[model samples]
Target: MRIFRKITTPSNYHHHQLRSYVSTCRAVVLPSFGGADKLQLRSDVPVPPLKPNHVLVRTRAVSVNPLDTRMRSGYGRSIFEPLLPLILGRDVSGEVAAVGESVRSVIVGQEVFGALHPTAVRGTYTDYAILSDDEVTPKPTSLSHVEASAIPFAALTAWRALKSTARISEGQRILIVGGGGAVGFAAIQIAVAAGCNVATTCGSQSVDRILAVGAEQAVDYVAEDVELAIKGKFDAVLDTIGVPETERMGINFLKRGGHYMTLQGEAASLTDRFGLAIGLPAATTFLLKRQIQYRYSHGIEYSWTFMRADIEGLIEIRKLCEAGKMKIPVDKTFPITQVKEAHEAKDNKLIPGKVVLELD
Candidate 1:
């Protein structure tokens, strides 16, 4: 790999300018598609040159997401296989080490936290990770790097579903199919912040946490009939568990002209199985058909939502975090050297909540 602007010592980060920056840094690379053992922590991974709108973050903490584990197991092989040796992380919290020439919104030496797109190749699991300008914003002073790292990816996902896709307005009723998980929990809070009455389904253990975060109703899915427990129809339903049965139930719970969105879209799976050429169009057709069918039969909108980098949403999420209103509890933390162990825990479900990787 080509290297440039090499520095032998850590440059002063208290200033707002980066005259020189490190060209190589520590990163966890997935050299091949497989289990956690395939993850290699190398100290000399090359850092790509920043684009005009890019910001280089000196990584402090990154979270292990479900997509990272799935990607390790060859989940997005069609798109990622050829791009082997990919860094596998989405959420990041750290200081701005450098900025591209055209950047102005955020300056060097400022603390920031944000998440990358799910399909990004150059991920955040590095000593220095590249994120687009809008993909990151000022970190909330109320949260640490680890705590800030946990919120963006999960919260942005819920934001995309509730705010972007559903366009939920105040005083509306929202139903979240699975509220125990990070995305579901964040959805509950986002909906409540928007003045929507929130109802959710989860295991009994998560009931308290769900309610603590402003959910009006929490039904234990294992012990109760969801339809009977959730009394009224909803303006929108965000189904984190996209199983056919849950999809049907969520659809039924929505009022006419309401929206139903799911996190598990078949776009990636179809493309992985059928190859991109055939799979891309196939997935589009399938999604269109489902949307049409649901719209015609139930008079509602159906969509597949994914986490995206939204500056406005990210800023609002930061504000919520500043006010102690949004957060995802970190279950366990591992040093960057223990990335393999982190992935293993996530794969075996040993750590049910968020898992983070810290870099010194």
Candidate 2:
């Protein structure tokens, strides 16, 4: 004789139900920073509780970056604390394991890839990672998980530097220093895809690969003088290496008000103007000369890049891949246990392309 009351839904009932869901996932943890050998690979680290707009992913693969090595050795620790025994690894490709209550863009089991936050880098290197909905993008169907893993950090950085910072367009002459590296290779393709005239520098052996990637010319940094090979003004320069004096030489290559951007230094300046910060020698040069019209400043333009894992962006990159407009070169792959060796390979520049750690 039990009577069932008319079921009425409460507006907030779903919120409680969602919280119960994220309480159950595991991740790997890093005990300290030293060598990759210091990574503990724990399986009991708690999965982050999904924020209202976050999604939890079961990681499939991750790509290593040199920055990871620096972070592991405690180089940038002052700027970022490793919530210790933290997890490490930045680029991730995975399937949707779960979603927070407010997330609407993806469903469980959808494949995706993106850069994990510096703190979350660890979790991705493990079995699961929870990401803000905005930080994860749909994994391109055309690429394998390993291929997708390699695209996030390098590709996004190249995109922001060339397309966003430099604003390069068709017919613009651009120079990409360190063009044989991962980011440089991506830059060449992105610039060429926009119909720009591209030149890059690498070892002599890498010239053919660079040319095949659509660079109009590839200069061997060891055998040729990069500054002399081009012999004219460039609309933009994407300097990836941190050579101290290259910036000075790069200044000579820029047309009036031309943009110069770099991964490792402040914008290059030609004049000896004043009122600039103390750290940037190039800025000091511009200040000293007071080169009013010809001095252009850039480098603080890539803020949104840190949060870039947009599905639209990756989809666009995939189109380039499908059309043979870009190439994905995976130099090597390591098992999850060989994480330390992978970092050494990257740090020593032993690998030709992205080094990925395959977990699945």
Candidate 3:
């Protein structure tokens, strides 16, 4: 926000004698358009500068997500252009490199992590990244940087989907399809912590891991049909996989007036009423109606959740981690130079847990 000295120079020595030097770092760049394996290696891109309400982070680790793969393949060309040879990543855990004049709360050299909207700022694939002060939270001391980097995107999406849309209540029966995935696993943990009974669908290999994360019952999706195996009506259903048929199957499983939340697909909107709940009733009527509907017929309510990166939300996740209420599932980490492999692993769901990029 404030600049003491601003000059363009070929090297730090040309401008000052004692400026902190952290150049010669490696970063993954998408040179033009290509597949994940082709993410070019660029070693000289300057670490971006800090802005007011922004802090520069010395990235210790950055995680791979589905979006990273898309970005690497030029799938986001419309939104991420004039391309600028962008770096692709979402989750970041690292120490603060520098702070802007107006920045507060986070100080230099403190460890922190969050989901960085790289298209807006710059991606976390680089060794250092400039972050909005509002998008980061102090890292829990109990978590390694790799562990912390794994949670931001998946954990936050899970939290918002359950807390904001489902309003999970005590004794509520919730069904989470695709509970083996990162976001789904996180939802299971948060739901159990909320005093709700959870049932999730995962492959046989992942069933134990899903249960370990707190699901009351793990459905072997490959072996059994979720709708047929789980007979009791649910208060809420989280369809994370969002297959058209999957959504259709889960829709009728909800108790009348119950809510359906999805991370993908637009097939069903939450605004529609089903069964005896025939109107857009007031809050009280809807709650009462849902309670009443549970007594007789099933209801279908749906939502497509869009996630945001918020500091307070990340702080809450940090607290949960410290209390042992949240789990960070990271299966593999690749060096910054191997970013292409990291993206591929995430895209193919080859890793059981989150994938990360380790930086120097």
Best-fitting candidate, scored by lDDT = 1
lDDT of 1 by residue, 1-360 (tens): 234484332243334333467788889998899989999989899887777789999999999888889998999899999998799999999999888766777887899999999989989999999999999999999999999999899999999999998999999999999898989988998898999999999998899999998999999999998889999899999999999999999999989999999999999999998999999999999999999999999999999999999999999999998887898889999999999999999999898889999999
Tens-digit lDDT track for model 3 on 120-237?
A: 5367888777678887889889999999998888888888888877788889998999888888888898888889999988889788887787788998988987667877888888
lDDT of 1 at 25: 89
TM-score of each model, paired residue for residue? 0.95, 0.80, 0.82
Please say which candidate is ahead in lDDT: 1 or 3.
1
How many angstroms is residue 232 displaced in model 3 relative to the true structure, after the best TM-score fit? Answer: 1.5
lDDT, model 2, position 140: 73
Candidates ranked, most accurate by lDDT first: 1, 3, 2
Off by over 4 Å in 3: 1-25, 118-121, 266-300, 347-349
State the lDDT of candidate 2 residue by residue for 36-80, as single tens digits.
677665545665555667777778888887656766776545333
